[model samples]
Target chain A: MAKILASSKDAMAHVKSGMTLMVGGFGVCGLPENLVHALAETNVKDITLISNNGSVDNWGNGKLIANKQIVKLFASYIGENSELAEQFISGQIDVELVPQGTLAERIRAGGAGIPAFFTPTGFGTKVAEGKEARNINGKDCILEEALLADVSFVKAHKADKLGNLVFNKTAQNFNPLMATAGKITIVEVEEIVENGELDPDEIHLPSIYVNYIVKGEQYDRRIEKRTYSSATS
Target chain B: MTGVSKKERIAQRLAKELQDGYYVNLGIGIPTLVANYIPDGMDIVLQSENGLLGIGPYPLEKDMDPDLINAGKETISTLPGSVFFNSAESFAMIRGGHVDASFLGAMEVSENGDIANYMIPGKMVKGMGGAMDLVAGSENVIVAMMHTSRDGKSKVLKECSLPLTGLKCVKKIVSDMGVMEVTPNGLVLLETAEGFTIDDVVNATEAKITVSENCLVGTY
Candidate 1:
C-alpha cells in the first residue's frame, strides 16, 4: 500500500510546473480544496487545468485562477471566473470550450487510453471548423480526441490504507475518472480508515490508480447556490 | 413562417404544452425562456448540460441569491433535495439518457429533421455546450424560435447546408409560424401561429411539409 500523507501539501510534492493537471469538480461540489490549497503554495505556473467548472471567485480551482497560475483551461463552463474571461478576451490565456458531455468523454477517453472518439457536439459550427467529420447512418458525427493529464486531483469521502476510495453523494464527479486517467493521481479524503475495512463494492475508485492519499482538513460546507421559495409564497 | 416580431409568442405557446414532473434540459437563448414561464404547477425538471439539474431560474435583482447560478454561468437557485455534482457525474446523466426532455433553439431545421444551430455563415464562434448530448440523450427534444431569419430566409430547409448539431434528434419544432413534428415519415405540420396555412408555411420553407389532421394555428 502507498503511504498516506497527513496533508495535501505533502501529497502534492510530486507535482511540477508546466504540467497538465485535471481537477475534479462541478461548480463548487466535490472540489478538492486541500490539494488546491497545496497547489497554491507551490511555485508552479503555466498549468493547463481541465475541469467542468472554473471555481467561482476565490475558491476551488479559483485559487489557481486567482494566483494566475493556469496558462490554459479546458472547460465547459468558463463564465464563473471573471479573471478567466478577461484573460480569454485579452488573448492572454488559452481556453478550449468543449461541450459538457464531450469534455467528460475527452477526459475519460484520455484516461482509458482511447485516442479519440467521434460525436456530434460541434459538428458544423465554430467548434468543428478544423475537426474531421464522418457521416454515420446519414448523421454527421465529428471526431474529438481524448485528454490525458500529467496530474489529476480528486476529492472523496473515505479511503482505507490500500487507497480504495469511497465518495458520498455529489462528490462522485470526475474523481473516479481522474483517478484512472493521470500519470500521478492525488486524492484528498475526508477520512482514512484501516486497510480492508471498506467493502469492495463500496469502493468507487480502486487503489491501483491513486498514487497519493491525503487526509483532508476540516471543511466549511458552503452552499454554492441557494434558491429558497418566495418568502410570501 | 411568420415575421420575427413573434418569437416570444411561439415559445410561450410551447411552454403551455409541457406536462408536470418531466426532467427537462433547456438549451441556450430562447430555450432558456422556458424557465421564466413554467406554468406555476408543472413539476418539470430542468437540466443544464454544463452540470446542473433542478436549477431554478435567475431571481429578481433584489431576490438574487449570490450563490445561485446555472451551468450557462448565469445566476440561479436550487430546489429542496437538489444536490450539487462534479462536472463528470453531471455529464454522465446527460450522456446516459437520464434527461427526460430538452427545449432547444435552432437557426435551421430540415425536412429530413437535421438541425443547423451552432454555426453561421462567417462568424468565428466557440463553445458547443451540451447541445449535442441533450438532443441525442433526452427523450423529447423541442426547438423554439422564429421560422425564418432576419433576411427573410426560412430556417426550414430541404437540407441543412450550415453546420449540424445533432442528427434526426429534434422531435418537435415550435416556431412563430407553426409547430411541426419530426416523424419517421417526414416533418408533419402539427399547428401554426395565427393566420398561417400549410401552403403559406410551404411557400416559406425550402423543403416539403406534411400537414397533420390536428393542425391548429395558435390564438395569441
Candidate 2:
C-alpha cells in the first residue's frame, strides 16, 4: 500500500536539490498543482525538470523556473514560458527540446524496463544530431534511450487507498505513463477511496506504480486559452 | 478576388486531400483550420497527438470540458465513438505509421521537398511538438502555409535556410498564393489562386517551379 501523506509539504518532501523530476501534464491540464506549489515553496535548487511543456509563465512548472530552481529543462514545447526562453537564450538554463512523441516513448520505455529503442520521429532533422540511426523496415530510425525520473508528480481524478488511479478524460494523457516511469511516484488526486473501491478495469494506473498519495486541494481547473462562440453562448 | 479569405482558401485546398475514413493529424496554425472545412458526411477521423482520436470542432462554452484539450491546448469536443488514451499509446499509433496523412505548418519548404518549421535559429518557437514524428511516419504529408513572409520573402525556396523539421518529407504544399507539389523533378506548380497569374506566382517564388499543363485557378 502507498503511504498517504498528511500534507502537500509532506508529499513534496521527497524532492531534493539536484534531482531529476518529471511532472505530468499537458499545458495546465492534469498538473499536480498542489504538489508543484509545494515543491516551489521549498529551497531545493539545481533541479532538472522534465515535462511536456515547461508550462506557462505563472503556473505549473513555470513557477519553479521562475524561482530559478530548475537548472535544466527537457520538454517538447517551451513557447508558453517567456522566462524559459530568456533563461535558455542567456545560458541561464540548459534546454533539450525533444519531439513530443519521443519524450513520451522514452518515458514509457523506461517503465517497461527497455533500455533503449529506435524511433523514426526525429531522423534526418536537428533532433537526430549526434544520435545513432539505422534502417528499420526500410525506414530510417534513430535510437533513443529511456528516460527515468527520481520522482514523478502525477495528478489524478480518483485514487484508492491502495493507490490505483483513475484520471479524468484527457487529463489522463501523461499521468499514467509518468506514474510508471518514476522511481517514486507521488499522486495528487481529487478523491481517495478505500481499497478495492475503484473498479479494476476503471483504473488507469495500477497501485504498484504509485508510492505515495496526497488528496489534492480544490482545483480551479483554469482553462489555458478560453475561446467562446455564439454556439456556446 | 473572391470573398473567401486567404486562410480559408488554403484550408479549403488542403481539406480536399482528406479521404473517407482516413486517419489524419493536423498541425497547429494553418493546418488546424482544415477541421472547419472537412467535407460534410465524410468520415475522416482527426488524431491529436495529446491522445485524442475522433477529434471534433471546438465545443461551445456551455458544454466545454476543461480537461478535453487539443495539442494546441485549445478546448475542444469529441465526436461519436471518440477514444482517448495515454500519450505514449497515442504516439505509438503515430510512429507506427497508422496515420494516413498529416497537414503541417512550415516556415520554409525546399525545392527538394525538405521542411523547416520548428525553429528559426534565434527566434522564439513553440518547438517541435509531434511534427518530426508526423512527417517521419505519416503516409503522406501536406504543408500549409503562406506563400511568402510578411517582408515579401518566398517561403518556397531552393533550400531551407532555417533548421529543418524533416528532410525531403513534404509531398504537397497549400499556401495563400497557390498549390504546389514536391516531386523529384523539383517544385511543380499544380494550381494558382484565383486572380493570381503564373507570372505573379513565379515572381514571388524563390524556387524553380514547373507549371503543370492542367494547372488552373484554384476552385476553393
Candidate 3:
C-alpha cells in the first residue's frame, strides 16, 4: 500500500541527480507546479528535462533552467524560454529538438509498451537524423524509438490515498499518458482525499502508474506571450 | 487575380470572410494572421493539431500565461469546455471530419483546385502536421495565399507542378489581389482588391486566368 505524502517536497525526496525525467504539460497548462518547485529546491544537477517546452523566464520548467539543474533537455519548443535560448546558443546545454507531436507520442509509446512506431512526421528533416527510414507503400517513414524516463512528474486535480487521480478537464493534458510511461511517476495533486473518495469513472490517472503523491503548493499558471488588440468594440 | 503587394493586404481580405461559430484550424504563416482580426465575441472554435480544443485568441501582455498556446506554438487563451489529449486523439478529430472548416496557406492552387503546401520543391522538408487530415476531414476548405511568388511567378495555375497535398480540396481562395472559388462549372471570378485589374492579374500570373462580368474590386 502506497502512503500519500503531504507536500511536493516529500514526494520528490526519492529523486536524485543525473536521472532522466519526463514531465507532462503542454505549454504550462497541466504542469506539476509543486513538484517542479520541489525539484528546484533540491541540489540535484545534470538532469535531462524531457517535456514539451522549457518553461519561459522564471516560470514552470524555466526555474529548473535557472537553477542549472538540467544539463540536457529533449523537447520540441524552446521558443518560450529566453534562458533556454541563451544556454543552447552558448552551448552550455545540450538540446535535441524533436517534432512536437513526435516527442509526445514517443513518450506515450514508451509507456504503452510499444518499442517504436514509424512516422512520416520527421522523415526528411533533421528529426530523422541518425534514425532508420523504411519505405511502406512507396512512402517513406522514419522509425523513431520510444522514449522512457527514469521518473515522470505529473499534475492532477484530486487524488485518493490509493493514488487514483481526477484531473480537471484540460488539466488532464499529459498527466494520464506520462503516468503510464515513467518508471517512477510522481503526481502532485491539488487536493488529496480519503481512499475510495475519487469517483471510479472520474479517475484520470489510476493508482497503478502513480508511485508518489503530494499536494501542490500554489499555482500562478503564467502565460508565455500576449499579443493583443486595444480597441473599443 | 489581384496584382497588389501581398503581405498584410492578403491577411485583411481573408479576415473579412470569417463567419461566427465556425470551427477553424488556421494554417501557419499568413493564415495565422486570421487570429489577429477575429470579430469581437464571434465564439469561433479554434482547433490545434497539437491537441488543444478551445483556443481563444492570443492573450494580452498583462494576461499572458506561458503555458497556454495555439498550434503555432504561440501562447493563447482558452474558452470554456476546452479539453486536452494525446496526439493520437487529436489526429482523430482532424482525420474524422469533425472540424467544420480548415483555413490553410497554400503554395499553389491548380485549375482543378489541387493544393500543394506541405513540401518544398527541393531538399528535405519538415513533417506534415495535420494538413493532409485537415484537407480530407474538414467539411469546408478555404485557402489564403498570395497571388504570386516573390519571383513574380503565378500561384494560381492551370495545373499544380508541385506535389499535391490534397486532390481538389480547395473551395474558395483569397489572394492579395483577387478572390476565386472552385465551382462545379470552373473557377468563378469573385472579386479583386482595389488597384488591380484583370489584365494586371493575368500578366502577373503564369496561367490563363478566367474573368467574369461580376468582378468588382474589393476594399478590405
lDDT of 2 by residue, B1-220 (tens): 4787888889988999999999999998888889888999988999999989998777878877778999888988888999989999989888788999999999999998899988877775668988888887776999999999999999999999988888789999988888889999998888898778877888899998989898887455
For every model in order, what is the number of clashing pairs?
5, 0, 10
What is the per-residue lDDT of model 3 for residues A1-233, given as tens digits with 9 covering 90 to 100?
34677778887777899999988876677789788878898999999988877866777788999888999988766665778777877779988776555676678799889999886555544556799989878656779888888899988878898888887644565667788888898888778899877778877667998888877888876544355544342
Interface RMSD of each: 5.3, 1.3, 5.5
Identify the candidate with maximal TM-score: 2
Worst 10 residues of 1 chain A by lDDT: A224-233
Provide the overall lDDT of each model, using Cα atoms, as 2-decimal numbers: 0.75, 0.89, 0.74
True contacts kept of each: 0.29, 0.78, 0.20
Q: B26-128 in candidate 3: lDDT tens per residue?
A: 8878878777677798777778876678777665556655445666656666778777655556656665577777889988997667787755634323334
Off by over 4 Å in 2: none
By summed lDDT, the worst window of 10 consecutive residues in model 3 chain B runs over B121-130
Per-residue lDDT tens digits for candidate 2, residues A1-233, read 79999888998679999999999999898889999989999999999998999898977798999999999898998897898889889999999999989999999999899999998888888888999999978888899999999999999999999899999888988899889999999999999999888888888888999999999876878788775456633
Which regions of candidate 3 fall more than 4 Å away from where they truly are? A137-139, A225-233, B1-23, B27-45, B54-88, B95-101, B104-175, B178-192, B197-220
